[model samples]
Target chain A: MQKRISQREIARLANVRQETVSAVLNPNSRGNTRVSAESRERILRIAAEHNYRPNLQARILRGDSGSNLIGVLINARISQFFYDLLLPLEVELRKRHRRMIIGQLGNDAAEAESVLQNFIDYNLDGVIVLHHDISDGRRLFNHYLPLLPETVFLEVPPGVSGAAAVSIDFANGVREAVAHLAAGGRRRIALCMNDLRFLSMQMRLEGYRRGLEEAGRPFDESLIFIREPRPDYTFAELISDAVDLLAVRGKADAVIAGNDEWALALLREMNRRGLPVPGKVALVGYGNILNICRSTTPELTSIHHGMEELAAKLAAALEKPGTRFPPVLSHLVVRQSSI
Target chain B: MQKRISQREIARLANVRQETVSAVLNPNSRGNTRVSAESRERILRIAAEHNYRPNLQARILRGDSGSNLIGVLINARISQFFYDLLLPLEVELRKRHRRMIIGQLGNDAAEAESVLQNFIDYNLDGVIVLHHDISDGRRLFNHYLPLLPETVFLEVPPGVSGAAAVSIDFANGVREAVAHLAAGGRRRIALCMNDLRFLSMQMRLEGYRRGLEEAGRPFDESLIFIREPRPDYTFAELISDAVDLLAVRGKADAVIAGNDEWALALLREMNRRGLPVPGKVALVGYGNILNICRSTTPELTSIHHGMEELAAKLAAALEKPGTRFPPVLSHLVVRQSSI
Candidate 1:
């Protein structure tokens, strides 16, 4: 193991006081006497040769820390989605020596604003909100836009935007799923949905629309079916009614759902009705809920949202501002159903 | 709503500048004489009334933030637990105007140490460790003790020591469950376990032994069995040999599992052999895994570890320095089996 040189050794070698060494180490001299540029460079060179990284904690204790702390707001109700994304993001942020804090917002914009205001009170460098309804989302931007301190928001639906945005690109993710079905010569595809209120739905819909338009396949509205998202909804009559509406009104050679949970439910309903998935209706569920959905008759081909990549981009956005990030693309994880 | 008074206003009112106000707000200031004590007091009083707070970003950018960041090392594997606990702690910390940074140590202690060391290098005010093993437990006091920063460890088993700890008292929790069973007239008891090596299991076992002794019942070692935890084990022969051994040697009237998953497995294993739970063997589980144990032949009587309390304590420990937390006591929620 290599021995680490101390600040004292560097000071002795440079023939400068320890205080001078400290000033150079901080990289930011607020009220302290400005050291000469040449002297600063010589001190740094000597320090580098000795591999003398000034104990950062010692500097912070002396009132200097370059590492910034940022808040990340995520409500508990949507914790399932939030945690899945956060775990990777935490790792990435820590790597760049930036600290991340967690925050939860109430359902309304007022509470969200309160939480945002609280972050401001704490003097956080920036914030990233995981769940923001359109109304609340607009309010968050309007509140923080004045400060504009590297603000970031995730999953804000297209069109309603303020702040540096990063989201799993559902458009490309869903388009690939549809393209896979199209390649397999499937027409009359159905887009199953739980709710169209979420930003994710818009992206899924965009991809679904784009795939059909490019394939020259007529978009069939009759086959589109809406169902309750609850897991227990499998036993409810609404699921059967929705399946019946899809099967009776028209034929759907493939189905794309708003998200993974609904897609799994639709697959379960289809399986119960003796539908042989790909042979009957090829399926692709968005988001990576494959661990639970893989057991279905023909495992649903799904989109991997690339949590690692999204985390990387999110970290980079926080680290090096002005570095453009194109929307993170989700890969089509080809499975049994969409084959 | 009334607008918040800026720190500038307080500074002006107190015959000082905004930076002076900032300096005054820092209660932990060792000896910065940029502002007089009289001006500091006057500014604080006015700021409190007007709800004036420091801007975190400006303070950090200007190299002056009073808020401390606490780093927590959490187990990366338990996604669900991470979501449940970390979310509430975040909210509470914000109320105290502190920030938390999270690091996940996925089964590797060395990696966890490196992550924790980085947090220290960044001059984090405090640190909390969740799910650290016995092997690395000594390092908490050994390597980290010299720094003398506020440190806390959670879920430490019996022997590991040398730092403040916050733990769920599963022993007392299980003792209460056993007492509940004793009250319901279960004299003959069998103990089955899934995670015998876990801290929870060890506490539960101690509870079982103490509960039996309190009830003046003899401890039966022959009836005790440990099995690998899984869902597949539930409906099948996950512990057939243990079941037969307990039945023939122990002749137990009631069975208590180390945790909920193991309890469910035992329940179904017995059910498959045409044995009715509670009729022949009253069964109880721990840690209420939602829905699976319920909707069974005899709904399980499960122990409820207060998630809210746990979350609250976790946050409190991060901010306030306490010798140790009171052991967590849980109530057994009776549905059918014991009741």
Candidate 2:
């Protein structure tokens, strides 16, 4: 093994004085002493040549510790559908004079848990974990958990014993979307949804049922599409069944889609058959993917799941430890697809 | 604030000793020095009542610092085109026992520059910057460059000087996509692109010209479409002249799309007009959105740029300094659409 290049060696290579190299190397060196232009250039070239790096160990030990960091672990990539939630969370955290350490989750659930544990071990001042179907819910409960730092879990239902919980109220949003379709002179209302067993989809399905019963409409079981959330599943399966239920099988007047992406898929399918949106059959979707909603002709009406609000609440839980907040309802965004 | 709750206060509140409180605080406190379980519970109960929390700042200083930590600055949202690149970077960085700190560019370009400047103040061992059009080109020439910590800029051509550079080698990727279309007996290829003024797009267009000249086809200016990069632009604006020249005027046989998403958009527009992809007209796209390519009926035959390979090289750059790596290319993932 080679002994790595030091600050002294970088100074030697740049052909500048060591003090000049140090001035550029440590941006916050005392007394605000400035380095000359020629020396600065030479020092940079030398640092590149020698690959001289600072000992962050010594620096952290001398009291400049965390730099106001909070770690957040989310299951999916920051999707357009969810940016409404995360933008405020990131911005608000910064406002409170804290920075975030974000770890994007991948396929493996174990990898997700491992990343969370690693963040905890790193001494993050607080943590906000975005919920997916985690395998370690039981594991999180097994031990008498340490009096850990302030922690917030988003998307998980409230009152998880001691932890602060925040989530978008999906049930209310679905209710509004379903009622909009049902009350607008539509009967035999069908639900185009993913599995009704998942927490979110289940709530949406429940809302659909409630909306149908109020309008004296029979809930059809065959209309539900359960794709099981696979990465490989073509959304075409969703549209094929959804359109068939409304256009062929159920003779339905309106259909509620599982999500905005799936709704867009159905609209494309309808466009293929030359079906005019809302003119022939009404449709609504969930999780408003903002830009995409606009591009589609006749645009998509969606239930906006207050992602930014959820993120803000989650961030507030981390920042202001003493405040207790409950789950909030989602808002509806109407467009040409449904109206 | 009010003398902030500490272990000493918890001991006083619980009516137990400070040593017992310390033992309760650190569950793994050196083996065999056991305090009574009842005292431990009481101490913890009092600590919770007072909202006692450990400062992670002091702890991280103890555990980390000497080891490696690399920072990455990206202009796009975690949702956008960069996921294919970032996921691999983190995976490879973890394998090399180094942690990653990510910084996202804000709405304004100047704000993003300050965000990049943050990496220097962060005391990062090294940094990988995803520099495309999102970052201002003039910032490259500015003498008051943020004192970066051994930075590497991607997609930036060589001879610009100052930092190490890595690029996707789209020179080869474009050559292959165009050559594959040209060799399939298609001539007068039309190109549909967005934001031609971007530095990266300039290189891609150059590669397109190089491919066409090699195939002995005259590059017709009339067959090219340049629209605003925003997705909200209607298909009419995007397909202007290019489609008219290809379909109406019979100027071209195949169309090379701007990127994967743009290709998909063009595919949708063509599908609406009763045009069969590749059967009636050949098409090729770049940046391989794997999920979309898989689902399209004819599927998209696309070139997969080695974002994963770039990430692994980034990780290697952080660990093994002094050598600049040439950008890597992932193979063309052939699906049903092109052939």
DockQ for all models: 0.19, 0.12
Worst 10 residues of 1 chain B by lDDT: B289-298
> In DockQ terms, which candidate is top?
1
Backbone clashes in model 1, listed as residue pairs: A123-B55, A123-B56, A123-B57
Best-performing candidate as measured by lDDT = 1
Each model: TM-score of chain B? 0.73, 0.72
Candidate 2 per-residue C-alpha lDDT over A185-261 given as tens digits, one digit per residue, 9 for 90 to 100: 76655667777666778788777777667667676776555554456765566567567766667676666777877
* Clashes per candidate, residues 3 or more apart or on different chains: 3, 3
**How does model 1 score on DockQ?**
0.19
Give the DockQ (C-alpha) for candidate 2: 0.12
Global fold similarity of model 2 (TM-score): 0.71
Task: Place model 1 in a CAPRI quality band.
Answer: incorrect
Per-residue lDDT over B143-259 for candidate 2, one digit per residue giving the tens place of the 0 to 100 score: 223355566666553334566666666656676767887888877677777775666577678778888878888888877776673567665665654566665576566787777
